[model samples]
Target: MLIGALLILTWLILLIRYPAKALPVSGAALIGLLLVGAWMYWLDTREARQLAHLELRLDYAPTRCPADRPLALTLKNGGGSPLQELRWRIAAYAPGDSVNLVETLYDAPRYRGPGELLPGDTWHDCLPLPPFRPGYRPDTLEFRAERLQGSFAD
Candidate 1:
């Protein structure tokens, strides 16, 4: 796209420098600009389609677990495109007092590999929970997928 713009700019400069050659230069510049616009539109549409077809499903096992037990989850791609990477945050919460404030036993984002995730692919692994001090019992698990990436053309 940048190259196309530079070429158009150079053509315009030449057109200004040579008034007699305006007709041919203008015709070529118009065609170049139209082709660039069409290419950009195609690229944009392809990206939108890819994003629309990308989906992720995270299934956590033993939502309530002892602090000593490892947290496990299965990540599945249930879409048409292959996923490149995914980042998410998981938190362990204890029972709240009067439903106003809950004790946070653990809270952090876990970074996962950019491994290829084809449609219907499932990746299972245990998440390393952060060490917690005493007086915290994990009663509930919270999960949020923060970012996602799909495959791109090289």
Candidate 2:
């Protein structure tokens, strides 16, 4: 935006100082801005496009230690590009409850997964879950992946 503002300001100054060169200069500046905008738009949408092809499966099991429940994550990258990073929200809900029992965000960089997930590959790992309320066992467990974000390999 600063660049754009500077470009416009320069164009205006050029127009007032020298009208002969203003048309050609403004044309070049307009083209440059269009190309830059298009490039930025493409870069912003690349991750979302790749994420559309990803499949995630979340499951959990009872552990002897209640506080140490481990969540099993199955990630399938069906996109044409390899994934560089991933983030998702995991929420645990009890049966017949509208609110979640526990919620956590899983960040690939922080958690350190099995490295970059390649295209057409499936990666499975057991991630540690945030502790739940003591002695609060639900009759049924629910797993849902929400607000998934990921970056594709260059």
Candidate 3:
């Protein structure tokens, strides 16, 4: 924006100084600005496409463990592009006696993945969880992928 302002100020000064050359110079400047704007828009759209082409799917496996209460989950890259440095959310819940009730719920902090997840690849890991709230045991667990960032192939 500052550059644009300076260019416009310079153009106005040129117009006042040389009326004969102002028309052609202003036309050239306008074309240059339009080309620059179009180039910027194209770059932004390419970045958006890269983001859209990255997707993920999460699968949970139930297992029994006395101490850690470990939960196994698999994260799959389901898009055309590769994904890396993923952040995820893990949550556990214990259902209540009545329908649609949650007796106990626990949410862990955001989990950062270690390495890149190539296209069509799956990452399997176990999440160690502490015991559920007193008098409540988890009936459902959820693993969600969030804040995804990746690049698409050219």
Candidate 4:
């Protein structure tokens, strides 16, 4: 933005330098438009995008029940493009047969990832997930991935 402002100032200065001592109105307008266009083009080229098959793993790294349980998740941006500070929410569900109902899980840790992940690289995140409901035991767990503004095209 600062550079854009400076360019505009320069253009205005040129226009005032020679009211009718030089160039035509169309010529000046063309130059100003080109400058702004070039700036926008550079920004678009650097903007991050989402590529497919970005692997994400959520696992029960370790658990002791009702006391101190730490959940670890790995986000691998395996695609070619690097994703920005994308807002995504992940929820993990232990099978209903796992924990007890008395343990009310009301909140979980929410965070924002800031590193630039290259292809084949992994980003690790540790979240304090809600306590697992007590029960017999869980055979399978399910997780859902949600993004604030879905796809870039959409």
Best by TM-score: 2
Pick by lDDT: 2 or 3, better one:
2
- Model 2 reaches what TM-score against the true structure? 0.66
Over 64-122, each residue of candidate 4 has an lDDT whose tens digit, in order, gives 32224355667776666655554556555556533232234345445455456666778
Which candidate should be chosen as best, given lDDT against the real structure?
A: 2
Per-candidate TM equals 0.45, 0.66, 0.47, 0.43
Clash-forming residue pairs, model 3: none
Model 3 lowest lDDT segment of ten: 95-104
Q: Across residues 1-154, which tens digit of lDDT does each residue of candidate 3 receive?
A: 9999998899889899997899897889789999999999998787666556554444344543334535555666666666656654444443333232222334533455547777787777666543344564444634344455444444
* Pick by lDDT: 1 or 4, better one: 1
Worst ten in a row by lDDT for model 2: 103-112
Q: Candidate 1 overall Cα lDDT vs. reference?
A: 0.57
TM-score ranking, high to low: 2, 3, 1, 4
Model 1 clash number: 0
lDDT of 2 by residue, 1-154 (tens): 9999997798788899998878787789789999999999998787678888999887774453244446777889999988888877666677677676663335422343345888889997776665454565543567667678777777
- Reference-based lDDT, residue 22, model 1: 83
As for lDDT, the candidate ahead, 1 or 3, is 3
Model 4 Cα displacement at 138 (Å)?
Answer: 8.3
Model 1 stretches astray by more than 4 angstroms = 1-17, 58-74, 81-114, 126-142, 152-154
